[model samples]
Target: MSRKDRDHFNLLCDIGELAALVTGSHNIETFMDSAVRLVSRHLKADVCSIYLYDESAEELILRATIGLNPKAVGRIRMKPGEGLVGATFENLHPIRESAAGGNPLFKYFEEADEERFESFLAVPIQRGVQRIGVLVVQHETADYFSERDVMALKASASQLAGAVENARLLMDLYEATGTHPEVQAPASLQFIRGQSASEGIAQGPITFFKKSHVAFLSGDAHRNENFTVEDFHEAVRQTSRQLADLQSRLAERLPESASLIFTAHFMILKDPKFIDRIVHQIAEGVSPPEAVKNVARHYINVFASSSHAYIREKVSDMEDLAGRILKNLFRRGAEKQENEKGKIVVAAELYPSEILKMASEEVQGVILVKGGITSHVSILARSLKIPLVIADHPHLMHLPEETPVLLDANVGNIYIRPDQEILLQFAGQEAAGKIAAASPSTVCRITQTGDGTRVRLLANINLLSELSTAKELNAEGIGLYRTEFPFIIRPTFPSEEEQYLVYKHLFDEMADREVTIRTLDIAGDKALVYANATSGKNPDLGLRSIRFSLRNRPLFEQQLRAILRAGAEARHLRIMFPMISSLDEFRDARSVVDACVRDLKREDLPHHPGPSIGMMVEVPSVVEIMPALAREADFFSIGTNDFIQYTLAVDRTNEKVADYYRAYHPAVLRGLARVVRAAKTAGREIAVCGEMGHETAYIPFLLGIGIRILSVGPQFLPALRERIAGLTLAEAERHARLLLAEDTLAGALKVLETPTSG
Candidate 1:
């Protein structure tokens, strides 16, 4: 063979060997060192270096060096368009300069190294459209690293992006599950049907933030117990600062509820106990990172292996807490890549802490890997009205990290490798959903159906912010203004004066219309600032709703006093209590209301007397004792949301059985019929303020059941009122009765959706 052919073959052999070694290397430092060495030897270059893209900083970080100044290996960063390497990254193409000093892109270089090198060749490493970094090979002869050499290096760069992606996934999984060697993506695709919560369509790029575990601890991480006490403290300090910073950033961006998760996580990181453990690791002579990693690992292991199921289950949370600390300590933003303008974020699961960490404006929607209809994340998503889907296929985590992805939350679908056609289709669908939502704002008006029964179209308002929206939707009044949210989020019992302020504001805002204020109906398990002060227990049957307030007479009286004061401020103010199981709970609550009115009169407190008071026909006992309870109460507002769960004996929080708690169930409908009949007999009004009211499909059935006030979400009012205006109450009643007698909810809904002869 000719010498040229032999040289080319040898270079090819060297490339293969280098590729194998670099791809197989577990240690990043060693991988770069060996890679640079191969480039220096094969290309006969005086200098070789690999510049990796530091995604968080948006700069090219020097990863390795050979035949160059040793200091440059650890201390070189090139901004985009700053140096020859930067120019290559900036242009997204390769560049070659025969004279190193003549290029304007050249920055400070080693004089001795420059003397020995005259030619330069830089190849931009790209994986798809993203440039991973740059590979520069320099030689003294001024003709080093030819076009073929650039092609070869560019090929090598492809493998590097794959390796980096693998390494990152491994790191993420290792931080989250503590299982080394991350689970690989499936060769074939699969899908999981997620529960639908919010109704909308959205398409955006995905941003994944899986909880990471703090890997630093004081142990023989590298088979050496060589950390000191000073090192441990330093490591603790570093990680603590990171955690604190993360908490600060999240607090600034997240809503009040979201801040709690980060707050709890921040506290865990600052715990002196963990800090001491970290110190112990340092005392053992481990490096700072090793010390932190070891201590964290040990804590994580103990928690994971704990016999207490709660403790063991909390390991994931603990890992997330630790990760927050590390994230804060590291405190680098997700580096922006080319074409990051509008990308949706998809994840296995999202917690408030992580979700809060992201920029809301940048996030179009989120697809979670693990969350449920009742998950806090879902609740927050609903509150924000953001499009989201929870518990998608696990394979979603394996998609290209930080790459553009499309999430279609409307149909509980996510499209991977979505080309322009698919994305355009999604955009069109999403726009249609939005247009449909906005188009119906002025659609509602007062009109009678063929049945000649007038149905009051009202809004089920929970937050004070919904008053304007309620008016905009042309709701006649507030059928149910859930007043329990404040109690749930408050740190202590809200004073009568504080309660009065809010109630008065709402009543005044809706002065021209009616407003039914449901008393504090806190369920157990949801964090309540005061009352019963228990750590953790089943709260469903615990002190909550009417039972909770009645037992605490003072609190109930205080709330009643506030309602009375607010009632005086408006012409139409209605008061209601939730979770009444029998006539006794109803009578007792009524007596309290009567007493509050009399006491207010005695105190010369100006208040409205004789405002309509009501009970929530939610519990089964209330349904059974409806007639007597209805006589004692002025009216009945059926809270079908909780009623459905209680009737089914289902914990809505339980992922395994929550789907069974359907509101349209025949059993629930029967209960609703009982309440409606009892209210009618008592010459009182009946309003439904639950998911049943919000759903358009269930409206006909509800009207047929003799419900006059249809209280629904503020957003649903315009559409619902429009539907109601076109309905005949008599036909609705007949349809509802026919539907209720049916054996299945689907059959009942089908009857409702069936065309009625106008």
Candidate 2:
């Protein structure tokens, strides 16, 4: 590499570090200023400036600068194609111009003091085609800037775009909540930002729930006396007993999720990977306690750092299992002691049972210091009506005990030591929020729009116990029966008969109503131990869903045969394949089902020869070939979570780029429309069996776009049904039209937030 190239590279690295520093700090203005100053100084430029794109206003406003009139920084604004900076943004390419003022695209802004510079270079700062800003540098001499300079600025801008955009988003949210990311916080108030896992406001003293028992244990972990290998084995046995008891108790309370919630803990306890690793450490002369901690940390770090969100959810389980083992390591029959009643509990993460225990203890709310919202935990907290928030702030661990904490999970914000005014406002809002819960009894048997267009509201069954809730909520049928949950109930995959019993029960419970059972959609990265599954990098797009099924043909056929056997006497049954990306993949999966039928027939076993075969409309490739896919698929169900994730290239659970996971984006909306249109053209049925169906704002749009079926979490059915009751078909069409017309996320968000009316 040339000396100048190396220098430019080093400069980019320095700027990347600077961007990371600014992300944590409140002053984004300082980030912009420092960025411009560094670029100007590094490149020996006369001026450098940052122009942040204001999406709402459709203009790029100068936010920070070096060498220009400082007074004009916040005052100057230009629309796309209005000036050289605007032209950079419009063209979405680096602009390197000598005698820059001579270019017809360049418009002089009198307040900016740019006339002194004869050379200009500007790079459009963007995050995945979303315009963030423009970075500009000027030189005193004409044609002073070279390709190396342009390349360096481009690299810096690319690295800084995410930081700038995140900081910008933080500022906007803060502004909405009457706080400022750019301003210094008061001594009395500390705010922690996180995603709202559950809805509602909660205020109480912050109580840190310590699960790791290392603090209470006496002596060094690596050299503890009397705690030998036998003692560790005994603790493992005792931990198993404790888990069984906990599961039994949880069954009486939260039966729906209790069956397999503790299964993970046991799996970790007995697994050779966990147990043998710890034993190996002890054999290496480390004490049992230290060995356990070492092995647990190894697994926790592995799971937490996984690229896929599925594996990330296992971080909490590892912690929970470690805590259980540690608690039983020395203290036998340790009483469940918690002084967190009516107090806000702050934890790194909580498994489902921990959440339940907190709820039982009358805990006001929970603030998770780390970890993403696991499905089990989120569902349990929501079911228990406890406010939960996942705060990414590092300050959460150091919070003084018993300090007043206000958790506004409804808005996904936490305020530590909130003042009197904030407390009073929340108290008033909480009181106002007491208008009566949406009753399941109010949901119509046949849900319809105000104009009498029938809409089928199905339930997403994750467990057998959820059947009661689905029935009570008037769900028409099981739309997306996630078959993988049954797999997680045991260590290895369930045998054909075991799966049959589960499915048979489901069919019997739902009676004659159609049940769309998705085949095993397990990913390799999750905690569920499978002998056949192999971990890989980027498991989200790796052999998952249908790909995994096809790769393991025997297991795939086993599951299909089980579903078929169970649905032998059932009048209405559907088998759906997840993550179907292509026409050939769908045909391959369907052929397996056909083979399963032939095997069942040849064996003289009773089986459903023709269950409805369908595919989940999740992969982006499926959307393009929808018409052809619809012709082959007996029906189609859109898994909006993965669909939107795939469509936007955003990890739905990732909080860093959570803002980009937009369901209302024109591409996603159009994709859904095209699928629905294709299904109609082919005379095939399609249902949305994802979380989007749970959103009230999205329900109208779904209906507007001719989606007649919405399969949501059973708990959401009541509110969804109520929301649909107030909207006419015509109004929904209008809402859909507005959404389709929107080219920007901001415009789509505005349309979604607006109340529907003709």
Q: Which stretches of candidate 1 lie over 4 Å from their true place?
A: 1-181, 190-192, 204-325, 331-363, 368-380, 392-404, 431-452, 487-505, 524-544, 552-568, 593-611, 648-667, 740-753
Per-residue CA lDDT of candidate 2, range 1-758, in tens?
45566556436544224523443232456656777877788889999998887665788888889989999976898899888899899988899998898998888888878798999999988643256789999988999998768767876775566456544433332222222233333455588778888887888998777523324332244354557787787777776666656555554544333333544454455444467778888989887887877887777676666554433555666776676677676564354533467799888766544676565457899998665553546655765678999878666766667888899998899988998999999888877667454422354788887888899989987667678889887899999888876565442455454466678778888876888999988663233443345546766777778887899786787689889977988888899999999999999999999999998787556789899899999988887799889879999999998898889998766677877888899999999999899998999998998878888889889998889998988878878888898889989998899999999988989999997742
**Residues 567-617, candidate 1, lDDT per residue (tens digit)?**
786888788888888777777888898899998787555688988888787
| Candidate maximizing TM-score | 2
TM accuracy, model 1: 0.59
- TM-scores for all candidates: the values are 0.59, 0.60
Q: Give the 10-residue window scoring lowest on summed lDDT in candidate 2.
A: 172-181
- Report, for every candidate in turn, its global Cα lDDT versus the true structure: 0.63, 0.74
lDDT of model number 1: 0.63
Candidate 2 lDDT (Cα, 0 to 1): 0.74
